[model samples]
Target: MAYHRRYSRPGTNRTPTCDKISEILGSADKLAGEYSFGGRADTLPPTPGLFVNGVGMILLPLVSEHAKKLIAKCRQSRDRPNMDMGKSWLQSDQVEMKNPSWQAGMEKLMKNIARGTGYMDIHFTACLTN
Candidate 1:
């Protein structure tokens, strides 16, 4: 999860703790991504590590200690996320977005994430079971 908003627009839900929108991106079993941007209710801007999935510039704790541990583990492991897989996944979505600005913004955001995480590519497919 990650969040870094100083102020929220009107009509949005207000929380006493913070006004940011915390996006918890995770798979069925574990969390996703190590972020250097948000880890607290009050992480200010100028965040160079403000991206979706990548090598984190610094571990600011996207969600919890688990995330930090996972990040460290992945870093140490020889296995790395497949860049092409993630790009394939996002290509269609980007086209669907239609708006040029939105598309560009998303690309930039993901690029930042990738850069920060040093290869935050993700393309997960799971078998379901109860």
Candidate 2:
């Protein structure tokens, strides 16, 4: 069985639940939110289990979104960063430090997606990021 979770969400990881969640996820089989294993907070299937076979298929939506000009341009920082509590903003480095669980989940997701697309020649590399 496999489990998947996304870390990049608003107000997510505000509390340091990563360690505890990792512990529980490692040992517990009857988990509450194991997505790949079919556990979900919502009863509905998380995804329709559609099989996507190519990298182009995955990139189409992202390219379409970008072409639509949906993404906002970032303002320049001059010793002033946006600090609205309701807003989520960070650089790549900050995201790695502040939202490690999300980063790990993203890495796992990318690996899975690559494998699913049949375009990946994966070699498992063991290393420590932190």
Candidate 2 residues 1-130, lDDT tens each? 4233424358765345765565566544443323343223332223322222221112323566443332232223434455553222223221112233534554665565445444356643333221
lDDT of 1 by residue, 1-130 (tens): 2333355569986675453233222231134335465333322233334232342333344567545543443322123355532212221111122234544455556565565554556532222121
Candidate 2 residue 70 C-alpha distance from true site, Å: 16
Model 2 stretches with alpha carbons more than 4 Å out: 1-73, 76-97, 122-130
Compared with the true structure, model 1 gives a TM-score of 0.22
TM-score of each: 0.22, 0.24
Q: Which of the numbered candidates is closest to the native, going by highest lDDT?
A: 1
Taken over the whole model, the C-alpha lDDT of each candidate is 0.39, 0.38
Q: What is the lDDT of candidate 1?
A: 0.39
Name every residue pair that clashes in candidate 1: 54-117, 55-116, 55-117, 55-118, 56-116, 56-117
Model 1, residue 87: distance off in Å is 28
